[model samples]
Target: MKLTFPIVIAGLLAVFSSCAKIEHKKIDDPAYLRVFNNLNYTVSIENKDEEQPFLAMLIDPETDTSGMPVSAAIVGDFLDQRDGYAPPYPSHVGSSNSFKNPEYPGKESVLVGPVLNGFDLSSWAQIPSGKHRVMFMFRPVNNTPFFQLEERLKKKVLIDTVLQLDSHEVYTLHILQKNFRTKKNGMVLRQEVFHKMPLSDSMIYVNFYNMSADGFADADISLKKRIPQSGLLMFGVKDVMNVWFSLFTNDELRNPVPGYRFRYMTSLRQNNTSNVVQPYYSFPLFAANGTDGIRTTAWQRISLMVPGMNPENNPYNDQAPAEVLGNYAVISCYGNGTKPGFERDILTVPNMIVNIHSGTNNPQSFATVNTIEIVNGRAYLTTIQRKYPTPIY
Candidate 1:
């Protein structure tokens, strides 16, 4: 009887040990990718269609016997969305609140990479390193998810190309409008390398990019005319402008702050196609003190200045009166400032003061790469987060 019991227990252990493995498998030889749909057709007077900008990205589609793709994996849906901070939560106090709408939810839009306020790589999607066929097709902006959407809705391909991804490399694919007049759009793939910098608690890394369609020769004339007279002067014959990071306390503009400004940071005539990744420029993370553990937040107003504009003058100050062409404000990282009233009031206004600040708590918790992208005459900020501790098992 004892021998029989031992044999039965051994058999039960074997059965328990051999249970099928259920886990989310990790990718092999993985490469990281993030997609941003910066394509703007609103400036197009004739060809602007509301549905043309919304795109669905397909990778390695499965083909049928007829050599046409029967099914595909959707990597990105609603690619018209931009990366940035999320909007404030809507108040549920009233039945018919101003923020309540069936068509638009206040949720922030994002791709397959870092989310708004994310500090780590947990959200970035991983794909096998090799050559893969990629396609971006126009999709309707509806409740239908990309995978469930009918094939008829994805027939129109805006971008079709093969991407060669290297092992352990990171890439950002940008869909930018090539020409507003011809309604042409294209994609620019940038291999991102986070260059190591001297460690400092007070400095933040940033780079500038001019992705506006106004750079193109065939850009819409109406768009160019929309630029304020001060901004046009800064554009000058070369369409070049300098970016200034001015420290402000209360309401005073403090330029001449060392290492806070860049001369001719970007040229408006150059598009993302011709873009080479600019070197990271370090700036003081806090305006009051140049060191950490002092203040949790610091505000700075970014101004777009003409190359010839005297650096000594403070554009933000009415008394000093510098030739500051325009300035940018962070309304929402998700591009929510594009709404009708907000767009006209905040985005189009030249003298409006838009102040961007560091985190309100634990400012040194994670590092960030702030990319100031200029589209048309306005500026948008996209922050790429990095260097936060991950869970160790």
Candidate 2:
């Protein structure tokens, strides 16, 4: 049967022996379907029809015990995981450089939940490898102290668009919200890893993910150096988008050279803010892995603490930097000049993978891919600048 937890999960006591050292690898098995959630709402998957159906029981309203919305049940599940040292726990653990999640005795554990952040990846939930139909359900509950506005709670379902799985490939079934306001939700897939690639080379590949609700359906990713200007990689909100590019940096230059740029625009400016004509947005990061193999400052791991990136309260204090670094870069589209992340937020946002060396745009925000890029050679990169009390020239 398909694995589905109830309001109170039975506990998958599969604790990691060492949280500090995680070497991600997929165990050899049949094709798997890991349900990846990137939404603020708690959810349940029903109407799970397939050649061999995966059965999961729902909280029957008639015999419900806790008397809470199914959505709330999921939220409750997330709350069960409390630790100052682990990932996915609440972002407030009175922390220092060590044990951000506040490692308590017997606190080294994780759980299954319907609601998840873009970075909160789950283990691959096994499924028969073939075409299948499944429906996602999310209930808008605004009572929590999270970022849900009065009108933020809107019910949604990501229709199955004929999901096909292969035994050799593990896929992330995720939901990327369009704008926080409109109901333009989409299901996008990211191949977490490819076993085909050699171990040494896989660590160097970089992939970019646009989770910002900026309303642009697509984005252009480019890496340029003075000698050979590499063409930009195209990414959209749909499909399984993964174009791997490795950054071969010299040992001296530990961090990837900064010449990375992510650009996109809002389809409708009014949706983002009540007052704003500038719908265009862009983010340019200064860190980089030098083009040649001789540069001293190579790309090393960096962390980013983004505010307002996740709707609830700001998450800089308690949450730890993402492990997806070296492979992922998350761009936050939600930010205002008056907001906390206005000035010093970028300092918290660094390029580890998703949140590493994060940069924001008054017009929009940008980050690196799953991997960082070192521009080949210094070339004149065109940019737009606004004149005081005048149009951007």
Candidate 3:
């Protein structure tokens, strides 16, 4: 099937608004249907403000011809490392002398989940002009005789023509999966090990496309909300996002001591906010790893803190810990002076939730929260801001 239409610019006066009209035209073509391996993903629709209208579609691979969606319930957040120390290295003592000292490192622990819930699509379609999409994929656990996983790996999801708007609508025609699929199981094992490593919990990618006959254009992501001066928010699938750190031991174990440094960095920006806030912290801890690797089995720990009901009243002390909040944390990353992670990489978690301690003065008590999710290690977040229609540039 093929989709065709003309995107009219409306008069030479040329103005762009959140609620601009969309026109689409469909032409008859060959009736052959194209199919591929199981396609799984989440699609979101937003109007002009670029927020709201967030929707999730889990294509059941077994019967969903469109593609099957991996059950998000199985994904959980769990911490595997806490209060752990780093490997030991040789240090210079007196002139030309080398010495190794016993050091300790410690980290708190927490677990993410097997289930990711709390999503709403009603608001997205109501926005003036906001749309977005989130997708995820997971290979079945080994030795488990689950037919669903087997079926998901065999189906292909296609994006031909979306029926949301009837005019000037360009359908993204492609079948894609976020997770890696290999015939060999060894690669999967490598991925498992890498998953247990201390890498950044975020991924960034760029795509170039032809939106019109004029030429090719590049699309970038940025955070759309104003950084909150107070209150707390959650990021990540509370159950599955995990953090890990490893330690190695050498021959300096005489007295047996452990110590290390700690540092924390956090950032926040609100929708349409002109500025962002970044803060950093430092601390110390103790860690110890036995000479035997047997004693060094994998461990789970909480890397962040989750906020409480009265988080606002204690704005200064209301911050959620890393473990309870999971591995998700706002960073200083930006695009052209704009926060990028929220719009493209981390939109699945609620974007921004206003905390009204004494109660809200604006009747629009409707809080604006962005959402972010992960698929194959990539983060997708979205933000929507409302503003007066500005003249077309």
Best by lDDT: 1
Candidate order (TM-score): 1, 2, 3
lDDT of each: 0.49, 0.27, 0.21
TM-score of each: 0.64, 0.33, 0.19
Q: Where's the lowest-lDDT run of ten residues in candidate 3?
A: 183-192
True lDDT of residue 322, candidate 1: 21
Cα error of candidate 1 at position 89, Å? 18
TM-score, prediction 3: 0.19
Clashes of each: 2, 56, 118
RMSD of each: 10.5, 19.8, 25.8
**Residue lDDT tens for model 3, 70-97:** 3532111111111111111111112122
Off by over 4 Å in 3: 1-330, 333-369, 387-393
lDDT of 1 at 232: 33
Q: How would the candidate models be sorted by lDDT, starting from the highest? A: 1, 2, 3
Stretches of candidate 2 above 4 Å error?
1-29, 40-122, 140-161, 179-181, 191-193, 199-203, 214-343, 347-393
